[model samples]
Target: MNWFMEFLATGFYSGKLPKMPGTWGSIFAAVLAYFLWPSNPDFQVLVILITFFLSVVSSDYLARKLGDKDPDQVVIDEVLGVEITFFLLNPQGDLELTLAGLILFRIIDIMKPFPIRLFERLPGGWGITVDDAVAGVLANILLRVIGGFL
Candidate 1:
């Protein structure tokens, strides 16, 4: 059960990487988003929503079990974060847009500015997952707003 919890938390070992585990989890997320999410916008949104819900629960459970405030090993949150970016911004799976969202998400996620930082202080899994989700949303909005100018 401990192994299972870790497995779910780390996004199947992506987060176990010694360095930049969160980034590794996001990379895993990008691949999953590219390959698995349905082409239909509505179905794609559903998939993203489902993944996010599961990730939150998994993260909470792992954090509590692992006895960490927000276990660094729990990077399913990163998957949720990046999924939010791609789902909200590039539902069609445009490679360029997806890549852009990835870059923006990484920046905001790592920087954790303003409300992103605020979100990180929430209780349990909410603390672990929300900061990145907000970052993804910020990235999605920023990308869309910037795309408008291009």
Candidate 2:
């Protein structure tokens, strides 16, 4: 149903929140991941893959419904991005790491540098999702590097 798709695409209605819905959705994802995601790397990958798929499907549907290339209400992309940000690193549900990943992911997503921005030019769901996905990966890599140094 449309309501169900909308709920998913809107990141469980966090996107409907006034101001910076993407940030809200990212936070939601981070919090949810913190509580629900397990410590297994394989499980993390599986979760990410499943989230990515749902993001694409829901985003595409939302775009079509809203008649926008990337509606602000579709924050599932942000959710997926944040999930990818933590990836294998936040499986322990460490609040500090989760917070760091959330901040880094939001910054990278907002900045949209280099190839990250380029992904937005893709059609439909991919156009809406890949850019954030790249941002998430970049943030995760940055976290890994920072962890390595510390």
Candidate 3:
């Protein structure tokens, strides 16, 4: 159906998805990260980085197609960013790391520290996606630091 394709194309109705598309997308992304990232730190880190990059480039186009400014349903950016955040912890599919990464990503995402806010101001999809990438980076750093101590 036309609606179904549109939904998938816009990231499962996230573009017009209710509430905060970015936040919802990130939640979905976090869940995905839990399943996709390998137990091996190196592999997980690589995947995270790659995914982040791809999301950054793609989210804009997705947003445009959906006919909205950073539609809530086009949540791939958030999902990718959250995945990057959790990948920093290299959780081996553990719930604790997933939870921690989720909290950290959400906090930093909401706060939009410094350049993160700047990134959001960028034009088009890049603007839409970069902010979340920055949040992911910050969260990743914090998570890595905590990981070192644990």
Best by lDDT: 2
Instruction: For residues 1-150, write the lDDT of model 3, one tens digit per residue.
Output: 555444443456554557776667666666666676676778876776676565555665666666766666666677767767865365547778887888898899888889799887788877877787788889989988887799
TM-score of each: 0.88, 0.96, 0.76
- Over 4 Å off, model 3: 1-17, 40-46, 148-150
- Per-structure clash totals for the candidates: 0, 0, 8
- State the displacement of the C-alpha of residue 46, model 3, in Å, after optimal TM-score superposition: 5.3
Best by TM-score: 2
lDDT string for model 2 (1-150, tens) is 989989999999999999999998998898898898777889888988988888899999999988999999899999989888888775456888888888899999999989899999999999898999999999999989987887
Cα lDDT of candidate 2 equals 0.89
Error of 2 at 96 (Å): 1.0
